[model samples]
Target: MTTTRTADPTAEPGAPSTTTQASLYQQLRAHLAVLRLYDAAEHLPAVLDAAIAEGLSMTAALERLLAVEVDATEARRLAGRLRFACLPTPATLAEFDYDAAPGVDRALIDELATCRYLESATNILLIGPPGTGKTHLAIGLVRSAAEAGYRTYFTTAADLAARCHRAAIEGRWATTMRFYAGPTLLAIDELGYLALPAEAAAAIFQVVSQRYLKTSIVLTSNRGVGAWGEILGDTTVAAAMLDRLLHRSVVLNLDGDSYRLRAHQARNETLRKTTTGTRKPLS
Candidate 1:
């Protein structure tokens, strides 16, 4: 039988040294050419160049590609946390308890995965007193949306407002707004925690207004519909904001004992070790 050189596994091929070039792409390309990986290296150049342009070293990019290539078995496991488009999805929905929202309708859970609405770019309002997993469920929903290969962006209302304010001061308002507005689904969490300045409120409202019927957003707030006017500080602005947000929106009113308080009690009980195995001092 004749042995073929291309199929030979023990070939001592020439290897390129990396002492000359300032970049990883040049070095890898040279090495690949020396090893006669011209066809394989064709794809590597573009991927490597893109990674380098994004400020990653050639070696680092190759390492990342190798990890991805070798972890083929983890393709399914990576689905939830990996393929997110606009929002980040959690690793699993199993950790969240839907039973906590006492008066909440079960229709909301069904709506969580409803991509048609999100693709149409509607709003999802998650309102609650405090805790009650409003943020958790919002985040979980956003995560699920992201895992399904939708682009997602997440921020607190305060953070988004502050960022917009800073951008205006820095004269980067247009650029910042363009970037923030481009996401397919933007999640604004913790809405009622801080009072936004008039300008900040206006900026945030502009974002909400611009997003109306154009993009989806997951809003988590601790305000009742009645109290939102006070939080926004301008009735007309608030009214307009409400008109934009509430239309085509799925509102989830989550109310119950504060999860923070329950967590505190649980932690205290766990630490209470005594001689009688009760609430006595450990000493």
Candidate 2:
């Protein structure tokens, strides 16, 4: 007697059986969805192809997939932080014109860029005349801090003072103060641009007191320390705030003509020489 074999019921006539393969794909998608690995799930096929083509081990393939997901997640997080920071512009140390601002200490600025001062809650005070790149330096350092994974904030002294005053009136001063102090690095620019009233002066002092020794600060001012009392309109408050800030601060006084003015003059001279083949006499 001859025995005859029967075909599998799950197999098709001209196609390989794919029940196990389909089941695995479904299970993978479900797990990835549950774990919120959308990016990895979307790129799974391509990455798998690459891995297989490269003869990667199972462990190596997993690492490659996870690395892509991790990188995407970190990029999104950094973008969110930068948006929340509200930096005037995206400034970096590389874009800074070190040659134009000779007064600034390149070595010190570079060291600060490493974000070591933040570990110790040290303050940085950029004192300079108008257009001497104080604001640029402050923004650069704050950007650096943010890139280094530190929470950072940027606000002008006038704006901060106004916010604090409003919060006080609304009985939300504590909450607002906490928000300002929460950042790892808070950069307050144009400190002496507008003279503060007594209430604003007090508000400024409260913020400084709250964050003193707790977080780092990068302050840019066009006024000297002695003039702060008059600018803030409260001698005692100014003294106290300065005492706290200056105690552990790195002070840099930028002494030079305004960078903006110099740039403007250079442009004008170029234009004059171009228009009429003669140099314009300086006043």
RMSD from true fold, candidate 1: 10.0
Which 10 successive residues of model 1 have the least lDDT summed? 10-19
- For model 1, residues 213-238, the per-residue Cα lDDT tens digits are 88988888898877877888877888
Model 1 has an lDDT value of: 0.72
Model 1 TM-score is 0.67
lDDT of 1 at 178: 81
User: Model 1 segments beyond 4 Å from truth?
Assistant: 1-92, 273-275, 278-283
TM-score of 2: 0.89
